[model samples]
Target: MVTPTLALLHTSPVHVPVFEGLRDQDHPGFALRHLVHEDLLARARAEGPEAVADDIQELLVRTVAEGAGVVLCTCSTIGAVAEARAAAVGVPLVRVDRPMAAEAVAAGRSVAVVATLESTLGPTRVLVEEEAARAGRPVDVTTVLVEGAWERFEAGDREGHTRLIVDAVDALEGVDSVVLAQASMADAADRATLPVPVVSSPRPGLRAAVLRCAEGVKS
Candidate 1:
């Protein structure tokens, strides 16, 4: 029996450890490979989503060519574009926050999507709505951008970034669940002391990717 390799596409290097930890603990049998496009997010933010579509598509192609059983895009900002290019890659491509979105939609009627970057807000909200439609449920999705949090993250002030996200989670009212839109914000979900259930991408997303890899191998 051969173990399938799972490739993780990341826009930020910060997520490397998060997923690595999860894989080590839960799916140690599967091999993990990471391709980090550290500047991809900045390009998306400056030039808009369409500008990065080609780059994302090319990356997915490369990942598949490298023998990845499945590729998981870890950036919410580029998730939609990745999905658009999935057919071209001819591999199982997943968005890290996808599982979180489905969970959020199923967990409650009203869900709040909290993100540190404005670029993530739109894509994350769209994911939630799409999940709701797939589940045949009507969900009210709200987007919240934590001001100054991205700057803190860019400056390597993870503590500050997590603090802001925690505050945002605390402030979300009348929501049944809060979805942390970025993989980097997974730490915030752990730190948050909130009334509503707070969800993040790392664990659930990686688990799904591992399962996909297993399915591919079995097939």
Candidate 2:
């Protein structure tokens, strides 16, 4: 019998280590695979979400065909498209931010979403609101984009990228919790000196993905 694989769909190479570390620490026995589409985000930003929906769907289908028992989309900007594709492909697809969003909404009435990318800001806010609605809780959501951080990340200056995110968290006020919108920003959550909880996507999201895959295997 073949081992089931947990596939990760990533827009940036930075997530490779992040998820690998999570799997090593918490899910050592699970098979892992990565599909990095570096240009997917650029295309989504230039042509809109619908423009790249088909390509994402095709990738998800291929991942499952290649033995992925489940897939996780690490890019918040393309998460909605990934969900639709996951349904069509008949495999469980997890959006990295959903677990964080659900926790953020449950943790506070007022939530702040901080992202380095403009494309992530809207979708993350929408996700938080959706989760709040599902829980029958009312939430006030705010979004912040840390300027120039993504460029620093692109240049491989992770410290600078993290510093900008930490600074953004420092600037937020009256928020019950601050949600870091990307898996790449997870480290910033640890470094933040905020009075409220600072949540990032990677750890909780990976935990959920692993659980889903395990449950699927059992069934």
Candidate 3:
């Protein structure tokens, strides 16, 4: 039986509370189920995306099979892998970065995809370009990996991670919009005082997931 709950697949434990807060603020009483597999990202980082493809596919299929009408992949590193299994999973699925990428491409011709991990950069950049193509908006996508930021994030220095990301955003000179590749970087969006818009995944992605669940949309 398909439930009304919105299922979220994450690569980090941090997103549990983050999305919980967003849901609490935006959609009180909305049912949510989160599944985190940090090892998928770690192995992908050490090896490559292919290293975790099977794991991501299985996890995604399992998430939907467990009665999730809608599933959202919150990690950009393995987002494409998860989305690829959507057809086989047979449900409304969303990659967190897609909505943010679409917004970034629409905001300007030059979109900068910022990530703390190098593995996240390529997928995110491609996602931005894909969104641009879908919107018929030509975009110059640039991938920027903020050095040393991931260390801070992994070390549990949340403030340091946000500070580095915010600094990176502030340092960017010529960009139509900045897309935060990982949902963990959402805090930096508010911390950034850039002239150009700073896009983050959690808000728009969760909103899209909630809407999908409400309308029973299949994507």
lDDT score of residue 166 within candidate 3? 98
Clashes of each: 0, 0, 0
lDDT of 3 by residue, 68-142 (tens): 888888989988877886766575688888989888888899889999999999999889888988999889988
For residues 1-219, write the lDDT of model 2, one tens digit per residue: 444678999998878988898899988867779889988999998887778999998888877888888898999999988887788768689988899999999898999999999988988999999999999999999999999999999999999999999998998889999999988889899899989989999999989888888778688
For model 3, state the Cα shift of residue 163 in Å: 0.7
Predictions: Cα RMSD each: 1.1, 1.2, 1.9
Clashing pairs in 3: none
Candidate 2 total steric clashes: 0
Better of 1 and 3 by TM-score: 1
**Top lDDT hit:** 2
Q: What TM-scores do the predictions have?
A: 0.96, 0.97, 0.95
Model 2 TM-score? 0.97
**Every candidate's lDDT:** 0.88, 0.89, 0.88
